[model samples]
Target: MTTTFGATSTTDEVLQGVDLSGKRVLVTGVSAGLGVETARTLAAHGAKVVGAARDLAKAERATSEARAGAANGGSLELIELDLASLKSVRACADALVADGRPFDVVIANAGVMRTPFGHTEDGFETQFGTNHLGHFVFVNRIASLIAPGGRLVNVSSAGHRYSDVDLDDPNFERTPYEPMVSYGRSKTANILFAVEFDRRHKSRGVRATALHPGGIPTELARHMEPGEIERMLEQINAQAATEGQPPFQWKTVSQGSATSVWAAFVGQADEVGGRYCENCHVSSVTDGTIGIISEGVRRYALDPEHAKALWAKSEEMVGERF
Candidate 1:
């Protein structure tokens, strides 16, 4: 039976009665925010979690706290990964491959939000590079290492409604870059990646899903300027007005991670695979009248043709085949 876990459901609440012993999970951006709660709660449920971060020192300290909160024989380890650097992404993937320990789930949870124009070390736009391409390459390299019936969860955002991927100029070579637009494109890519990945790998017993972890005030918003924040709030409030709904409310860290954790371990593979989830369930496709932080996936974000096209363009950009 499907349980309707809501916006306020905490990680522990969603995971109650779940036993993760012998489950191997990988979580990115575990140094802080939702990543920490995700890793910690899974570990608490007895999953062995490999927490990836750009800074080993910071991750070490963070995982120590995660370890303290773990129950049912849960534990966490640190791995170095700088998604803004393709070289680092490869290195981290290589390290995991060499370890040869198959994963039960891989959570592509690391991402940057609205940021000023900049390029990654690989010369892609910062948000797209780090959020989508980085995870793209990482997942391609490690796809074979996920155990049968395993999952790949990409932590996307509701912002995907803001824009769709412009395959011709994803890096803004021809168009002007707007921080939120770029972030939206990246998020859209995240969902498409999961869609295509599931199509290609489901026969091999690996399922892929993407999700919006709810609106939580976290470090991911550190890049937003005050004016940008104000503008975004205005947009959200305006959208809410038209929808005849209340303004959005921010979730706590544990609540923010509930959907992701549920996607990873709670639902049936066929039920969750290739779907964009929020509030711990598969979201319906809706028009943009929904508030910025509201629950729903956009039709464009789940288009099969778009998913396949993105897979091809991503292969060209990363210079690797999956």
Candidate 2:
């Protein structure tokens, strides 16, 4: 077993002594929460960080906050990117490519949870469309700009444990869309996307990994009802109330961002592609005591056949290839 960093591990803890000098990292959803923390930590470690967000104003604010928190070698740049729109993703990629600056890490940390039933401008369900399909196209379009040994960290969630992929009705066209199920499908897609991406690109010096950032009290909860949030916490506490139980808990933004930053800059993950990570470590594949995964890849998430099929279907939907 590898060193296990718990959900309390801070971003700086995971990145301690991991110098990213001269590395270029693009971090999406940097307007707040774990994304902002991840970007800040990377920048602090000497990476040239590009912060992507839907709103320029919010992006600027995030950059300012990061700068105020910068240590040695900290640098940040803001860029416009709305994952909800394929056109926006393409344009952002084009801009970066045209600039001739290569990225060493692309952290797909931005996502929406439990969005109402709707479709992207490209006509796909909101969660599957924005969270998975948008990122699908983004990664492919920007593949050339990702340098050898580069990392692509898809920031999935433990909520993925809730469900698996629905191949027949991925877009909910044939079936009614339930928010949680749609979110689960998209999260599952995030991991599979990494698995297939690594298979295709690892030899080219690019690697992809997916991560569950652990539960955090982040902006992600803004969409949930207050009662729902209370219920969620009550449920967690209820589980922890058992004798000899470790406390069921939530992470702060820094803690939640740790695994992602670790995947990006830690040497342990180098040459190790397509693994699912959490709590600043590679998560265990087995069902464990109290059902908490300590650290290996989930079999279902790593199913290569499913990944390939999803890739083809995604390309058909996006109207392009890597």
Candidate 3:
């Protein structure tokens, strides 16, 4: 079904000839990077986009080019959202619900990366709290605003293979906090959130899925120590050399975000629902922590029982049941 799209495909390339004139979409993290590119391309193709960002001023500046280029009755509206804070997430969700606008898709695209040991405003671990729990409560609270036959696209990562959710210590109270470890837990949680969410909402034709936007150099790595990213690329390239695979080639923001829009609007609903996707297609369940870097969803990331457990844990942490 996605024969024409692959790792190198850009958002504009994937959405070519596809009309989105009447669609309304919600995209979080629109202050920069793939989020802005995703919103831009969608609006250029004629969808109304509600762009949410923790810093509205930053978002407005970033989206200036997008607003100027929009066509086909497309438009963009900025909204304030801070995923790390439940109060902010809830306030945003309540505002959207009050507006009574139905979204064709809700893209929980905002997240933090390997931050140093810290806690959110709610005292939860920064990575897990911001990347997973924050979106968890935010999406669940606004679940009804998604129109039937809609989609929820969680921007996850291949980093999930680094670790699985530690339900007992989601906040890393006992476990030693390494940035990637926490990031992995949070990313894995993203996939599992989609797994359970799809099961709960697919019957109503609203399907949930997660995707790994291939390795890209984005502001998401703002938390990394200086030169840490360069070290990572060297390591990845070294690994690829041993495996006879191509070395790392950074994806442009457009290419990285293609899979997100593809999964949200083009991929087959039944095939992608509750599944993890990458490279513009349904990812194979590799079922393990591979040695070298590569593509594939980890088996643990899609486990149904684990998904259910995470849902319970998230509800407990957020103090809200969906």
Candidate 4:
């Protein structure tokens, strides 16, 4: 029987009856928000979860609550990871590889939201570099360690509707940089990366998927100025008006994490892989337009050709091949 979980479902609810004993899972951005809840839920189900973050001390503190709540044989470990730095990504990947532990699931759940225009240490646009490229390099470097039947879940966003990747000017070198636009491009890249990664790796029994973890008031918005936040709320209300729907509601962290946990553990790879999920199910494809409160994914975000192109571009930018 198919169990349908909804947007309000919590991680524990979505994972009901699921057994994760002996499962080795990796979750990024576990310092707070949805990441913390995701790791806690997985660990509470007997999964040995490694939580990766930019700050080990912060992660330890943030996840201490999770460790206290662990059930069965569940456990949490912290590892240092700074997605904006290529050197850090490489080192993290190398450390995981050296550990010689195969992972059943890898959730790239950490990300930066709309921020002032800036560049990563590698000189790429900050959002794109940290959100997409960092995970791209990390995943590719550690791809071999994913056990057969393993899953990769990229935590994307509905904000992808705001813009698609600008292949030629990804760094905003020629075009003017808009913070939300850059964020949209990066989120779109997250879905596209999953698409291509699934296409290429499915033959090896590894599947990939992406999802929008719903709108939650998390530290992800810490960088947004008050004016930007107001502007975003105005856009959301305007979009809601057009859709004839209620204004967007903020999801609790548990609700925001349900889809990622569900995608990681509850479904068949062949069925869920390469799809974009929201509200705990595969999302429909919609016209690519800017609508912050829209329900479906944009067509361009799921384009296989764009996925392949992004893969190539990512390889070039990272100075490596997957």
> Largest TM-score belongs to which candidate?
3
Q: Write the per-residue lDDT of candidate 1 for residues 1-322, one digit (tens) a residue.
A: 6566888999999999889999999999999899999999999999999999998898888678788887777788888999999999999999999989999999999999999999999999999999999999999899989988999999999989989999999999999999989999999999999999999999989999999998898999998877876777888888887778788777999999999999999877999999999998899998856456667899999999999999999999999988
Give the alpha carbon lDDT tens digit for every residue of 1-322 in model 4.
8887898899999999888999999999999999999999999999999999998889999999899988889899899999999999999999999988999999999999887989999999999999999999999899998899999999999999989999988999999989989999999999999999999899989999999999899999998887877787888888788778898888999999999998999866777899999998888988844665677999999999999999999999989987
How many clashing residue pairs are found in candidate 3? Answer: 0
Point out the higher-scoring one by lDDT: 2 or 4: 4
The lowest-lDDT stretch of 10 consecutive residues in candidate 4 is 286-295
Instruction: List TM-scores for all candidates, in order.
Output: 0.97, 0.92, 0.97, 0.97
Least accurate 10 contiguous residues by lDDT in model 1: 287-296
lDDT for residue 72 in candidate 2, whole number 0-100: 62
Q: After superposition, how far is residue 178 of candidate 3 from its true place, in Å?
A: 0.5
Which residue pairs show backbone clashes in model 4? none
Worst 10 residues of 3 by lDDT: 287-296
Q: Which whole-number lDDT from 0 to 100 does residue 53 have in model 4?
A: 97
RMSD of 3: 1.3
Separate clash counts for every candidate: 1, 4, 0, 0
What tens digits encode model 2's per-residue C-alpha lDDT throughout 1-322? 4445667889888777777888888998989888889888888888888888988898787668686666666688888988889999999988888898889999999999988899888888999998999889887888888898788999987666656788778889888778887888899899999989988888988899999888777777676776997776666666656535566666788898988888887735453478888877777564432223223345677788989988988888888976
> After superposing candidate 4, which stretches have Cα over 4 Å from the reference?
none
